[model samples]
Target: MAATISPSSPNYHASISNTTINNLFDDSLTEIFCKLPCKSLFTCKSVSKRWLTLISNPNFHSLFLTHQHTLFQKTQALGEDLDQPSFILKPYNALVITPNSPSLQLGPLENHLSLSFLGPNFEPTNIVPQLRSVLKFVFACSNGLLVYGNPRPRHRCIYHIRNPLTKDSLELPCALTLCDHAGVLVGFTCDPYYHLETDKTKNAKVSIFSASQRRFRVVRIPAFSDTRSAFDVEVFYSETGKWKNFLVSCPKGFACGFFLTASSVEHEGKLYFMGGGRVLVYDPYENERVASVIELPRGFGEAYRGCLGVSCGTLQLSEFPISPSSAFEAYSGRVWELKHCGKGEETTTTTTTWELVHEFCLPEVVGPGFEELKANESENVKGCSRILAFHPYVRDTVFLKFGDNIICCNLLTRRFKVSKYGGLSLLFYPVIPIVIPWWPTPIPALPL
Candidate 1:
């Protein structure tokens, strides 16, 4: 018996083995690679030409992104715990803003202080000018992407949506360039439902390069005041590349007076902004230009500042009462839960109200002396704190900023822990739920 040999080499007999290897590298390999964490996938891109092409393919990226989303949602639904969210300190100077490798100080529980740094491996080509101008502000973040911009006078500001994970960013034109008003508040939110298609088998390739499919929408709510009650609402939809304007009339008692000083909270597909004495809930998904106003409990006067937050799927508002007597002292704080009372009749909208759920003094909960701060300084550092953000996955917990320190407090257990670092003007924890791999990979490191 004789075997046929190819003209190029005598290895023609290995055809059967070669065919098996080729078949194994086909779709099955792609399926496994799609499930790899983004950092690992980035490393896997250099394995081989075939591997690089497969990972870089638009279809493959779409599949991977959707798979990651599905995994996050499933884990979130299962009530799993994740690491404490990291904070990005507000840039104190142009140098701080331009640094590629920035130190992320962690406020992990206990008096422990740990320091980790993000690599200077990314190029700031898209946001260099804005970052250098001292006008850049990170208005909002979703998942791991950030919405930031250079705000200018005459109602003009250049905006950008960025993803630190991928070192990519998209610049947006000034939507309010023509206006002559001040105190305009801008916010950002990412809706994957509207951004990405769940069924990757259908028209998914086009979504890979779609900016709108990858980013969030920019919302600009007019600053209503005592004299002006009506204004145009401008919303920019990333996918459509168009701005939709809606003229909204505030109810007699409801207006976003002094909204510039108060921040807006996004929960369950709505934006909550503080008004004079009530909170205005805006449903950007709704067609009408109307926003529902929820009044605060009686005696929670307009002078008291409010921070909006969401915990355990409930809208929580914390009030900080400032008084001259306690201007240099710590005072008691209050947390209120907003309850949806009843479905409105056919002709009316949904009815909502609030109830006070918890109360605690700032000094007592944070302890008389924080380990991070000096004993002498702790006594001098006495003032009410402002709520920064709530722990995304934890229950009944919120982060507060007092003087130069950041503290995490649990309302249910009445416990508090302070971050060891100071001089942080703003803080943000990247929203990706899983702990990304760090060694030899570009995935950002976390301070354990």
Candidate 2:
């Protein structure tokens, strides 16, 4: 027979006091707090003075940051199964932020850097300290460097590159002469590499800002012309810092009108882009001469419009299949594979092959469901019908419309993850709300 202890007994206080809360080593306390979900950490902060001091320490703050990033990656991987709409008809104009605490609210997007959040019903109290600006452009972020720019055309079009985390900003002098060109378009990207002998520190390269001094730097390809029947010319990233020139050189008399949508997929040690009826691959260090271009799958040119004018679609690369040898590539309209093949006699070739994996149609466009939803909204939702694409770097593909909601399709399992949100114009510029993933690294050679 054993004696039982009750909370009402005087011995309860003895038991509690005997086991000192402060006696728990710092490492043990940290491990326990780290294991708790982000929501619980907030509640635990108020539990005791010891916990409050432990949680508020800088070391713990760093741990929480790492945990938050890991959670984001995991959540993004599972986003395909979220409860999204069958057809996202409305445009998502609002910025979404994901914080460490689930109960924390997302603040407004006015003059502030908005990090993406994982929960619904955003609140205002949960905004982070570093992100407080109406971010204009995120050039590149890698390691700890984040580059961003705001085109102040009225005052010489200044481009600002800054790391929000470190609060380090480099204002690059305008690369172009204001007198020569009427307008300029600034773009940024990063390339990750692996060196056998060197440590990982030297592996990644990023192109934050480039200036066109004398001539307008345009992607040049031979046997291509500016004709209406031909595919339009666009720039793409093959390596971290290099841009590949793609010319939509359709056959001479093929009466095909091509619209261009561009997106990048990182596989193995290279980054590939799909656009204008062709897939282009680039290796940053090894292959420096030219990018290898492969023709799109049969009938891809005829299925849908090539691209959404000048507004390039999103690109997401994921480590799937649970093997280091396997990866998945996704674009706005399609998903494919970046396969490594044996080296031939003269050349070592890596090919980008499309499998025609998934095809999706918006629910609002297919039925009267959109009309009923629109009628029920507050004040008439005034927006045109258009297609929006999202590649969340994990699961399958998602397509949204200006008035329709969000719809995701799994590439490997061939299933639909249901979630819905109203859509907006397809022609609107996409807001890449997060910080640029790479910056301050050497610029990779652009494809010639």
lDDT for model 1: 0.52
Q: Model 1, 238-323: lDDT tens per residue?
A: 66655678876656446555432365667766777677677766777664377667777776744235667666668887765433
Candidate 2, residues 23-99, lDDT tens digits: the string is 77889889777666533565687988888898766567555544444554465566434332122112223222223
- Let me know the TM-score candidate 2 reaches against the reference structure: 0.47
Query: Which segments of candidate 2 are over 4 A away from where they belong?
Result: 1-23, 36-80, 83-147, 152-294, 302-341, 363-394, 402-404, 409-426, 431-448
lDDT of model 2 at residue 372? 56
- Stretches of candidate 1 off by over 4 Å are 1-37, 46-83, 90-136, 178-181, 193-216, 227-229, 258-261, 301-304, 321-329, 344-348, 368-384, 424-448
Let me know the TM-score candidate 1 reaches against the reference structure. Answer: 0.65
lDDT of each: 0.52, 0.36
TM-score per prediction, in order, is 0.65, 0.47
Per-candidate clashes, comma-separated: 0, 52
lDDT of 2 at 185: 25
Cα lDDT, model 2, residue 77: 66
Best by lDDT: 1
